[model samples]
Target: MFLDNLSAFLTHPVTGTVLLMVGIIGIALELLFFSSGLLALAGVAGFGLYFLGFYLAGFASFGDLAVLGLGLVLLILELVVPSFGILSVLGAICLFGGVLMASSDPKEAAFMLVIALLVAIVVVIAAIRTFKHRGIWNRFILKEQLTMSKGFTSSPDRSNLVGLTGEAITPLRPAGTALIQGERVDVVTHGSFISVNKAIIVVEVEGVRVVVKAADDQPNH
Candidate 1:
């Protein structure tokens, strides 16, 4: 009797609509805000209640429930494991299929799915603009800028070596090491291979890259 009464209430259009909205909103907020799983739990609960109500009302078959459960698992996996949106796409298809199968009215299910998608998109965009720098995204993204002021350099500056002459320590197939000012420095030639022990001049220095040419070769400048 209690189950029947609960089903009678849940099967009402208003109750189903409310439950569906709550589930979708909760899940979206969980993904966007990373609310320490509170919103996710609430969303799970909402979905659980919805499925139970529908099952009791004879609106959902075992297969429908299984499909919905699989979809929910895939969606959760998408959050835990990044598959570059593959899991999300599959989960969406399964979720929609399950909803359609469970609903007596396909039109109503489709309408609700559309609303859910719109809400999710809006929430994701807003969250990205507001909280992107702080939350889960930060874990997988590089947010630091490497500038001279920050003492971050990709390589040591070789500008001081310009106009200096050095002997090639290794054959330069356009790239080799040279002893300049008694310090071994890496250098590249202008599309020409230089033999080992060959005398070379530092023709240019761009950041960490030292450009060299044969000592007998005239400097471009």
Candidate 2:
């Protein structure tokens, strides 16, 4: 009787939805926190169980499983290589299509899938915002790259100091710091040595490399 009850639950609509939600949350957690940790395994297992339940209930076909496998591959590729979210989107579509194929009732499957996704999104948001400060988050997620991935960035545009003039803060033996516009900036000379506190002028600017030369009273060549 216990075995029968377990089987019934496994085949239940709610169980399938819960499994899908777990799959989504697990994978998301793995990516956000684990990097290459056990959360990813949990996600894979969740998806596996979800499909397995449908198969045991005689609802999922081999073709459906194949599609799900393709989706998984796409998602993995999305992580390993940056495709600007294109691979991720395609993977999601494939997974959804697989779910539809595996369901005996397409409309009911879609409804459950939609509900699971909405709840997963809410759960993920809460985890990221409300519980982000909790110790558990830092333990799971790689915080080292968090700042660089989505935070304040250093300005790389040094084109403003192109025409500005300044003094050499350090001896520019082809590469040194100079005081440009009264501000000490890192500058480089074109194969010419610049002395300290020398009257230098900006000759050219190539991106962040501030090219400079001694301000000699001669033809402005």
Candidate 3:
């Protein structure tokens, strides 16, 4: 007797459609080729389709509401709480139970499940395409910027400064070159300008030049 009733319910068109949609959705989610939004959409549509089919088949409205509420709660929990393994399992249970509760016949519920899977699958594919096209899903997501910010520094070449400090390189007519460590570098005189080769200290280093000042006063010649 139960088998005959189940067979008759499965023959319903609405039941079959929901079942197909559910299968598709399940496959799409597993493959990761769809977006979350698409999944949500499929869930909503699948729920509605199953509910309508059962209502048309003469199920009591009150029981249907209770079942629908449970399904909705499950979905809400999925979004509100961290998965924790419990939310997903509970949500699936609630959803399946809700469909069975809402349906006038068990076979109709099965049919709707299949349709729901199919819908889920299609939506999942669309979701994947949507994400890929947005450029967010690409391997190299960031394009290097041409303009660099301040504070960026590169390593200096130590050999470039090999002999460029402490020599009487600058004449100090306020400006001239100094030979320090065997290299010529521009330097400046501090306080009063002095002639070249009167003993100097490296006052500062700016780029290729080591600025200097006379240690003591000396003859202009």
Candidate 4:
């Protein structure tokens, strides 16, 4: 008699629909928004109530509850740990299986599963777009912008070194170190190899690049 009453209450059309909606919405919200676990708790509670109702109605069994619990645990772990999407896939599969098993009618179960999946996808896409530009999302997504306004300079200005004379300290197969005014400076030769200890003159300085040529070589115009 007790079981019959419980089944009657749970199988009520309005109550069953409401419970399912609450569970779906709660889980979606929890996944999309970064709350202090309040949304997660609500989601868990909603799912718990949903399963309890189904069990009371004889539409679900203890095995169904176990499967659902496993799915929930896997999903939670996917969020907390980085499994490269492995956990997520497994969790989704478990959830689908559990939900299917919990429904007495195959058609109803299939319909509900489709609706739930579509809703989850839409919510996830929307959330990603909305939060993609935020700073908090940067930690998970790699984004970098280098601008002069941000004080990011790719190369230093070496124009001052122009016209300075230096002696090649190392062979410049177009690039090597030189001694300019007793200070070691990095420099590049002008299309020709310069031997060590040879006198060279800086003919051009572009950004951080110091271009030099043999002192006796005719300078290019």
TM-scores of all candidate predictions against the true structure:
0.71, 0.59, 0.41, 0.70
The 10-residue segment with the lowest total lDDT in model 1: 11-20
Better of 1 and 2 by TM-score: 1
Q: How would you encode candidate 2's per-residue C-alpha lDDT over 1-221 as one tens digit per residue?
A: 66456546765789988988887887776555545747667767878887777787778889999998888788777667757678878988888898888888889889888998999899888877865665334755777654436764455667777767788888989899987766778888889898898888888877678898888736657
Better of 3 and 4 by lDDT: 4
Candidate 3 lDDT by residue in tens digits, 99-209: 667666667566666667656656766877776654323434545443326433343223344333465644578777666667665666554576667677665555544
- For all the candidates, what are their Cα RMSDs to the real structure? 4.3, 9.0, 12.1, 4.0
lDDT of each: 0.79, 0.78, 0.56, 0.74
In Å, residue 135's CA in model 1 sits off its true spot by 5.8
Candidate 2 has what TM-score?
0.59
Candidate with the larger lDDT of 1 and 4:
1
- Residue 72, candidate 1: alpha-carbon lDDT: 78
Ranked candidates, highest lDDT first: 1, 2, 4, 3
Model 3 quality (TM-score): 0.41
